[model samples]
Target: MQTPPPKSNCKSILTCLLVFLFFQVFTGTLDAQEWAKKMFATLEHDFGTVAKDSMQEFRFEFTNLYKEELHISAVRASCGCTIPTAEQDIVKTFEKGTILATYNTKAFAGARGATVTVTFDKPYFAEVQLQVNGFIRTDLAFSPASLAFGEFSLTDKPRMEFNVSHAGNTDWMITDVRSKNAYYEVEIIERTQLVNQVGYKMAVQLKGNIPVGYLQDDLIIVTNDVANQEIKLPVSGKVSAPVTLSPSSLLLGITSPETEINKRLILRADEPFTIESLTCDYPGVTFRTGSEAKKIHIVPVTFNAGLSPQKIQATITAKVNLNGEIILKCPLSATVE
Candidate 1:
C-alpha cells in the first residue's frame, strides 16, 4: 500500500506542474515584445510647488530597447492642465522621443497628479501612461488675463495687444511668452517702465492662416513675478477679407435662449456683381443671397442662440466672382446689446 502512493495524487501533482510551466512560457513570450523592456525616466516627477498663476514644463524621456525599429504613433496628456509637446507624434525607426508636459500651473492649483500617455504601433502597448505630480500655489491673480479682438479679414493684418498687471508684489516678471500654436507670433514689445507701470507690452499678431472657422488659442505668460508660474491669456478672433457688406457684425438684442433671429447685409456694386460664394465662420450660423444679382442684393445672415449663450460671435467670409481676386472677410460680432 505504501508503494502505491495514490496514483491519483501523483497525477494531480504532475498536472499542477504543467500548468505553471505553460503560464511561464506565455508570460515570457509577452515580455519579449518591444515595449516590455522599454525604459523611462522616473515613473513620476515632482515639480514641487509653484505659484498659483504660473507656467512650468516637465519633460519625460524614454527609449526603445527592442532590436527592431520602434514606432511611436502618438503622445497624449491626461488633462488640459498639462500640454504635451513632442518633436513628432510618430517616432520613426529606432529613435528617442520626449514628452514635454507643460503644466498650466495657473489653471491647476494645489497638489496634483497628471498623466501623459504614449501610444505605440506595436500591439504590445495599448497605451503607456507617464505620471507627473506637483503642488501649485494658491495665492496669485491676473487682470485682463485674456484678450479677444473679434473677427477681421485676411487682407487686414490685425494686431491685438493686452496687459498683465500684478497686485501682490513687484517681484513678479513675465519670464516667457508662448503660443498654443506656432502659426501666430507673440512678442514682448518692451519690458520697460511705462508711466511708472513696471510691466511688459505683449504684441499678439496672427497671420490669418487659421481655417475659416472659430479660431482660438491660449498665450501662456511665464512670469518670475510668481515663481515662474504661467497665466493663460485666451486669444480669440475672426479672419475675414474686405467685402462690400457694411456693418459686418450682427447683433440680436437680448433674445431668449430659444429665439432665432435674422438680418440682411447688402453685397452689391454700383453696376452688377456675382457672389461666387458666401460662408460663415460658425457652423451654428449660415448665410444666403437671392438671385446673385449685383444691384443692392440682400444677403441674409441668421443667428440661433436657442438654448445657447446670449452672446454669439463669428465671421462671414465672402468669395465674390470678380477679376480683382479679393479675399473679403468681415466679423459678425453679436451681443445682448
Candidate 2:
C-alpha cells in the first residue's frame, strides 16, 4: 500500500528549501548550546505574498532523534500576526510533533513576521526559535479564504469556486495558476473590473481518479507583481475508499522469541462492511476478527516471534465485503533481539 511521504522526502518546495537549511541546521546542531535545533525538520518558513484574509499556515514538524523522550513545555509567538501551537507535548523516539504556525491575515496586513519559540522542559532544557515571514497585501483579498474541496469519495469529481477582489489597482490581474499535482484543473475567469478595482473568479476541479489519501496541497498563483509574483493558495481534502485501516503503519517495540503481543486496530469505510477473512504476510502472525457488519470494525492482531532473533516486518491483509469485495492491508514492524 502507498503511504504518505515523510517530512524529509516531500514533493513540493520542500526539496528546494531543505537543501539550503539542511546544512545550516545540521552544522548548528553540532554546537553544544544549540543542540535542540537538530530535531526540527526546518527552522524557517516564508509564506510569501498572500491576499488579505488568506489564513495561511505552516507546520514546523520535529522528530526526536535522541534516545531520551522529548517534551515540549510551551510554544509562543513573538507577534500577533502569527499564532503558534504545539500539536503534541510529548514525543517518543522516532516520533514526530509539530509547531503549527498560523498567519493572522484578517487582523494584520503587510510585512507580517513572527518568531516562534518552542520551550522544552523534559529530557532537556532548551528552546528553539523558528522564523515565519509573510506579506499580507491589503489590496488583494479572497472571498472564501481558500479552495476547500471538503471530503469526498474515490468516485467523486468535486469542484469549488472562489473570487479574488483587488482594490486600488485596476491593472492587477492573475496571469496564471499553477499546481504541482496533476489531478486537478483550474479555470480563471475575469470578472468585471472598475476604474481602480479588479476581480477574478477561480474555479478548481478535481478528477475522479485521485489516489486515496489526504490531499494537502497548494496552488501557486502567478501575478504581475515585480517584487512578489507568486501567491500560495491552499487546497485540502480527503478521499475515502471502500475500506481503510487506521494507523496503517504500526510500530511494535523490542521483542524476543516466544513472546506474543496483542494489538488492536480500527477498520473503517463509508458504508457498512464485514471482514470475510484475514491473512498475514509473514509466519507466526494471526488476527482476530468479528462477524458483525458495520461501518467501523475493531480488529485485534497477535504476533509471535520466531526462535531466531531478527526484525519483524509484516503486512496484514483483510478481505472486506463492502460494495462487493475490497482488500485492506496494514504494515507493521518490530525488533526482536
Candidate 3:
C-alpha cells in the first residue's frame, strides 16, 4: 500500500489471474474425463441393424476405483424410446455396478439415437453421458406398442385394447397370445385384411385377484411371420392397495449421532380404517398415529441416531384393519455421520 502498483504491473497481475482461472477449468474437465475412463469399460453401443419387434439391451459396467464410496443419484435417457436402469446405486470401493439400456424397437423405428446421463452425488458431484444408436426395420407395427392399464384397484378387473398391423403379407396373422402370468387373459379379433395389409384388435384383461404393487411383464404374441415370428408387448401398471402410504421410501439423509429426527407420512385409503400397529425392525425407530381414524391418516416417525456412525435399513410395518389385518411395509433408509 505504501507504493501503489504501476499500470504495467497491475496488467501483469490481472493476466496471471486469468491464466490461473483457465488452468483450473481445463484441469477440472480433464479430471472428469479421467475418472470416467477409469470407471467405464465402454461409453457407447451401437445395435447396427435390429429386427423390428425384437428386444435389444446393453449394459455399461463400471467399477468404483476411488477409496470413498460412490453413489449414482439418477440415470436418465434422452428419449422415452430408450429405458435406462441402474442395477445398484451405492457402490463401495472396488465394487461394480451396471447401467442397463433397453431399446424399444417396436415403439421406435428407423435410425434412433439416445444419450443416457448418469449423475453421481456421493464422494463428489459428477456426471457421465453414454450414447446408444440403433436402426429398426419396419416389418411389423404395433399401435400402442405396450399395454398400460394405469392405476387400478386390486378388486377391479382392468381391460386394455390395442392394434397390431403388418405391412407386406395379407396372410400374416397372430397365431396365439401367451403369457406366463395366470392373472392375464387375451382375446384377439380380426379387424381388417387387404391385399398388402393385415390388422387385428387385441383385448387384454387383468384379473381382479392380482396382488398390490407395480406390475411389469411381457405378453408373447406368436405370429405367422416365419422369419420373425415372435413379438413381445410389455405390460405395465400399478395395482394400488386399499390403503396406500405416500412417500414409500423415507430418506433421512446424513445425521449426527444421538440426534433426533422426525418425519410425517400420509396414509390414504378408499375407505375408513384403523391402524392396529406400527413397528420397525430397528430398535432406535418408533412411530405414532393420530387419535382420529378415517380414510386419511398422519403418522409421525422418530428415529434416534445411535452412538456410532452407521447405515440403517429398516422396514416400517403398518397393520391396518380392513377385511382382516393387512400388513404394509415401507422401507426407510438413513446414514449417520
Among all candidates shown, the one with the greatest TM-score = 2
What's model 1's lDDT at 255?
A: 55
Task: Score each candidate by Cα lDDT.
Answer: 0.61, 0.80, 0.79
**Cα lDDT tens digits for candidate 2, 1-337:** 9987876667556767887799887666556337689878899998888888886878898866555788889999899999999999999865668888999999998898999999998886788999999988888888788777778875567888888887876877788888788878889865779878888887888875465666767788888877778888877787777678888767776778878988888988778889899888888888778898999998787888878887665677777787656656666776677
For model 2, state the Cα shift of residue 153 in Å: 2.5
lDDT tens digits by residue: candidate 1, 37-118: 3546455665555545644665576644333455567777777777777655554332345677777776677778778777
Query: After best superposition, candidate 3 residue 266: deviation in angstroms?
Result: 4.6
Task: List candidate 1 stretches off by more than 4 Å.
Answer: 1-43, 73-80, 83-87, 123-129, 141-337
Q: TM-score of each candidate?
A: 0.36, 0.67, 0.54
* Candidate 1 local lDDT, residue 128: 64
**Number of the top candidate by lDDT?**
2
User: lDDT tens digits, residues 240-293, model 3?
Assistant: 778888787676767899999999778888788889888889899888875556
